[model samples]
Target: MAYRKFRGTKLFTGKSWAPEDSVLITLPGGQVEAIVPASEAGEDIQAIEGILSPGFINAHCHLELSHMKSQIPPHTGMVPFLLRVMTNRQAAIETIQESIYLADQQMQKEGIVAVADICNTLHSLETKKSSPLQYHSFVEVSGFIGNTAQNRFDQGRAAWEKFREFGPASIVPHAPYSVSPELFRLINEFDPGCLLSMHNQESKAENDFFLTGQSALRDLYTAIGVNIGFFQPPQTTSLQAVLPYMNPANKLILVHNVLTSMDDLVCLEKHPVADTYFCVCPGANQYINQSMPPRFLLDDQVEKIVIGTDSLASNYQLSITEELKLLADFYPEIPMSHLLQWATMNGAMALNMDKKLGSFEKGKTPGVIALNNWQVTRLL
Candidate 1:
């Protein structure tokens, strides 16, 4: 906690990272004490090579499924993927514990200061309690069985309460296809002001199921012994159908969005929620649906776009930088500056941790991360 100056070869202040000149920030006790130009820097400054910036924020992730890394095959689409996950989600407790620990450590190493993790059970609470990274647990509420709405709500609430002692946690829906109208209403009654993050239109099949009632999901549900005959097609996009049920007061996060079309963006207007945001896990999109969210679908959406790695189950690793790198490799026009904001400030804002963990502003304890040729390195 002693005084030190972390002078970098180049520094990205969460806005710009250019001019290729020296930048210096003096810190004592993990707080930024001063920011001075290279000309004003004293000889005591500790110079280092690389791009220094605030740490990354994984806006959406599933740390509980850490043990399922590569457990299910990729590009199977949502129906097959969900079937595989449902069938194979359970593993030995020790294995699940070890994987979660390692994944948390990897996120810390990759400069992730905060994460918005999806939780379906309390299995990951111990890991979150001991991890260096800050976590906001989204206790996922998922049940399509209309008659079992109360039970599902109670289960989700119990999970949220279990995680609440560890950190900020709230009950949220799992996905559009998984939650019924009754269950969604129950979630609203539980707490309409809390933040909600859920899978949106990850694939066309989801839209197909809700829009036309003809989708693989129908068969999959029957195969799993879940009665869908009582469920009727909305004849509209999934998001549109769920919009009316959502409380405008709550902060909504729509994840994946691989199949979100230009038409789907129009449906967003019906969303009364003013604090809604979008999270794109580019790697997971490609892994599960064989296509990433198109650059056009994301061009105007930049203001709301935040990055997440989804889970190791559908991803090779949990590094937010790698997610950005994949996008950069594909879309060369998306300025690195924009990608950095999506990784840091935007994500922190989405998770409501902007005041402490986003930009390297005065008095903010935003952790320092060095991007050495686009590879994430924790400097603080």
Candidate 2:
């Protein structure tokens, strides 16, 4: 393999940033070979600008919806915004294929090494098969009509099979408001150990729906003409209601915890909470929900905090650097080191890809990424 050495003013090898004179050596195939202090490098070294770090792990994304960028209006509350996505997500086959192709290229340019992408269909499977980036597909299963739960579960399984050929894949529920309790149980029974991801407490209406059965979601269900006959109000927060259906020790990823509360955290902490992760999509949250997640309050509950772009439908850019900048802008007290951890290593651990990606460990092929201001470029 061809050998290449990159010199950077600073290097963040997942744990901490190295000072000026850091050299990262890699094979042309991308596996890290060795690292050395800058003084030891030849004067003709290929120097990299800005912070040299491992490629960003977009813990969540929806590359399939790249065709819908700007199609939905911004700052609409979660319920209505979801409805808009449901109604507007349609295009010619070639249009979708082209958009997915472009989106994949954009992410590569932004230095996304791995993704935990949400999929409702296998439309983007072809793009994934040929792409160099790693993917862990989350086949999103959504159905509230109790009678159709089995059918929806089966369909999700079929989608999972198709998606698995490209990479690691699992059937995951979309959100508590959209997935019936029976469907959640069906998923838990299918594979308790598989990584399960759900949209958690993105809106007050989601909590209100489970706690009192009175939320805008009720009106949405009525307007959509779906009878939730098998559903029963849990009279608790949405997170608490679904806890019983999940295996406590199983890995779970909760996205957009804008409404997650201290009580909900306490309840989860009392159970097996070791493997749980909370992912924040700050841009998407601000764009679609008109709010920012109370991330500071959730610092103590989760083992790791990861970042995501959500989707093009809700975010303008797919860069984790932009997400970290927004987080730092909102909570200026948080250290850049911690934010870098969230964007890199924490995301890798969350997706269970840490063994191969995340940091510049000797023998690990963690892809190289360069960060400048709020943009990222994949150097390897």
Candidate 3:
């Protein structure tokens, strides 16, 4: 069997940096063969500059809204940005398809091997079917009104069923503020063991809407002709309010969390799920709210934190390396290894793809990539 041997730059095996003299050995097709000493690697060793690591895993993305890239202005608060997305997301089918295709291509070029992508429609189904990347589709359901819960779940179920026919898919709530208690119950019961992903605490308005009855999110509902007058303030943070409705057995990915506070983390510890991963989209958070998530709190409190690019709708590009660079720039105290683990191993674990895509374990086929000064080159 033909084999590939590489040495030179530091090797990040997705969990830690390998010894400087180690040679990464793999089959030509990118399957993990072994990591052995330079003397053991034998003849024809390939050399490269920069850190070589496992391909990136995007824990969260919105592929269906790729067409709205650059159409929504930046730094508008979350509610306004969401409202604009609602208005601008509608486009010709050809345009939407082309955008999804391009977005998938871009992520591939950026060395993303697997993605946990959000879907409200089947716009990305065909693209995903033919793409080389692995995907876990999150069919998002939203209905704040109690009476509309069933209808919303049914709509989301239709999409979920379609996506599951092709790959791993789940019916998940859109967010705490946009999903009613009844809807959450419906989603939990639909698939008791299914994984979940949710937009959480992306803005102060989201927390304010739950803490007090007044927030721009309420106004957003009203502007869209949805009366939320029947709702009452929970008098607590959004995550705490929604905790009671979630299934304790389900593993959950809480995305964004731009406004997630230390108080919220404490409350979460009191009532934890089976497994929880905190996914931060720094680019989207900066673009939408002009604010950063409390990374210090997340790093201190959370065990499994991951990174994402979100979508073109709310970000300049879909590159996990760029996201890591932004986080590294903002928090220089964070080691690059931690950020790489977040983008690789932790993200794969978030999407339940860790066994095959997170590390250099024998028999696993994690793709390889080289990063020099944050520029990515996909090797496999």
lDDT score, candidate 2, position 209:
90
Say which candidate scores most in TM-score: 3
**Is candidate 1 or 3 superior in lDDT?**
3
| Candidate No. with top lDDT | 3
Q: For candidate 3, lDDT tens digit of each residue in 1-380?
A: 88988885889988899987888899989899999989888999889888989999999999999999889889988888988988888999999999999999999999999999999999999999999999999999998888899999999988888899888999999999999999999998988877999999998998899999789988899889998778889899999999989998899999988888888878888887788889999999989887776866557734588888999999999999999998888888888888889889888888889889988888888899999999999888
The root-mean-square deviation over C-alpha atoms between each candidate and the true structure, in angstroms, is: 1.6, 1.8, 1.0
lDDT of each: 0.84, 0.85, 0.89
Ranking by lDDT: 3, 2, 1
What's model 1's lDDT at 307?
96
Model 1 regions lying over 4 Å from their true place: 18-22
Sliding window of 10 residues with minimal summed lDDT for model 1: 17-26
lDDT-best of 2 and 3: 3
TM-score of 3: 0.98
How high a TM-score does candidate 1 get? 0.96
Off by over 4 Å in 3: none
